[model samples]
Target: MTHGRQGGDGASDPESAGGGASDPEDPDAPTPSDAFGALGGETRLAVVRALDTESPRAFSDLAEATDADTTAGFAYHLRRLTERFVRQREDERYELTDAGRSVARAVAAGTYTASVDRDPVELDEPCPLCDGDGLVAAVADNVTEVGCGDCGGTVLRLSLPPGGYAARDSDEFADAVDAHHRRRIESFDDGVCPECTATVSARIEPAEDEADHGASHRDDEYVPVQTVYECETCGADLRCPVALTLLDHPAVVAFYHDHDRDVRDRPIWNVGSEWRERAVSRDPWCIVVSVRLDGEVLVCYVAGDGRVVDHRRESREEPSARADADDSATGTHTDDSTAVSTDDAETVRANDTAESGPAES
Candidate 1:
């Protein structure tokens, strides 16, 4: 007889199908449809909800909790959910499995509800784009969004957990949502994922569909641009501005800190204009980035191999001999290393020999 086939005598054979019982780790195991079908019946769903309590309930207690008219009907439903949604303890009590608890929570959170009202509240922060004082926080369709009334810019938008809305006041909730986004961006800038610790890569690219996609902020009225970062392992990506990514660098943080400015204190869109890129040389394929801040401009030259070749900072104020002297004394005007000086203009070549350090990646 062929293996896994019936014998000519019609007698059962145990050795044909691997000579053993079915294995849970088999490659051809059943799909998730079986688990989903287990919850299809109303009675089974009711049993799952009844067992989602803090403590396990006895079989009789569960039947009563579900308000089944007869114990036989309740037992039938419980049997259908057993080992899938409902787990039976040694003491003959039933409780929800992790899957069962998740379904129960979804039901309780009104995941299937047809509609929800938007909860709107006023915020105290000003709009970075329009300098307007009309920032509002609202939750609609489970997403929490912060927007400006004057310029119609959607400043911050994020989705919260099912029950996250009722957990805090509006302001606190807004702060929590923004904090989560900030942490994600910072983690991406640092070349890793905050949640999974996976390595990431970043690049600056123009926003798609310029006519449809306005600038980063509403008041800018220019083509939108974005700095995109993607995790090499997880396939997760984040999009922001090139300036924002630069602000997360340690060198930029120290530079602004020395100028009596805290980069973290201001919204990213308000810190500087969007970075402008240009091809400085075609034969050598050199690219440069120009970014304008409050009273100074920064120019960074990058070679074709993607290394930073040079960086220069120019102040709007006139050059001062005393300021230059102090900057040189502090080793800030050195041509070889990454340092900033108070002179009218200071250039630092990537090959400089000063001891401070190279520009941060």
Candidate 2:
């Protein structure tokens, strides 16, 4: 009998018999590793960089641009990059794919450059901690950071694309950074990674010491808390303040808009501190937020699953004079301080929904 590895039925495995080579007609599925591996060689990386000019280059022109000593070597590397990072057109010219262009831009942006000192870009917003004109933005080691010069606390810091800072003025660049940060926070709050669209888990917790400045500033005595979103699939992490996260809610935006205030026009640090008092319960499992905007008081209850379970609005008015007098005479103030349980809160939400309409998420 011939000795061989076999299945339970004593038949030889077809994979073993064929030496496990994938079928060439299988459409050549490419993975993320394959894309990264395409840039492993310096010659291959130079080829990608040469194609970053936003125009296709002929094979001979590209080989010349990359300074290839041998055409055969260049062709071998180019073949490896095909269908993933680089693509050849019908006219026999080659161009970078979207992934290839992104990688090329990153390389051009010096994302791997060593950390160096850079001047800070002045911002229009004032530092909430110090009440000074010291808020500025800067980029170093591929990270964009904004902070107060006097307080020495970084208000925001994030990694960006290598070309993130090119061809933009200070104000415009600041706006772009802010927008990027806002979108990321909103995406994370919606239980998805903005970068990879992977499922994310989030929780509200006190900010780390580096990210918080409560101890040094008297006005910022209240310890700041952050809503952290971590992706289970991609391992991407984002941390934003609880107030900032809630500010993106439709109801919150409507409330601000009704009061003739545009929340988006204000800086996050300014708005976050103002609304921090509204966060009554910042429990990671369940959060209860109450905001008094103008003459209306809005109460929002967020469940552990990161959904707004109940939201209700009430006018900020006192009880009738007679009721107040009666309560005063009985040594009990007629205050709307009743503790709301989950069931009662849900009931109030239902009643509010039936009376008016459900608040937008």
The positional error of residue 346 in candidate 2, measured at the CA in angstroms, is: 6.5
Candidate 1 local lDDT, 1-361, one digit each (tens): 0111234686645443233433347656334566667777777877777776555988877777675678898888888788577888998887888878978987777665533335788777677668798878788876776788889988656665545555576667766655556677778767786645777776545556545655333211223345667655445666754445555555556556667776676543344333454432323333445554565545565433333446666663422343355466864442222122322122323223235544554
lDDT measured at residue 69 in model 2 versus the true structure, 0 to 100: 80
Which is the leading candidate under TM-score?
Answer: 2
Supply the global lDDT for candidate 1. 0.58
- Misplaced by over 4 Å in model 2 are 1-37, 54-57, 89-93, 114-117, 120-126, 129-139, 144-154, 169-172, 206-225, 277-284, 318-361
Q: Candidate 1 — which residues are off by over 4 angstroms?
A: 1-34, 41-46, 90-92, 108-116, 183-204, 210-224, 227-238, 242-361
lDDT per residue, candidate 2, 86-181, as tens digits? 999999999988878877877887767544334688887888678788988787764667789888877777665545566565566667666777
- lDDT over C-alpha atoms for residue 305 of model 2: 44
Considering every candidate listed, which one attains the maximal lDDT? Answer: 2
User: Residue 123, candidate 2: how far off, in angstroms?
Assistant: 4.7
Per-candidate TM-scores read 0.53, 0.66
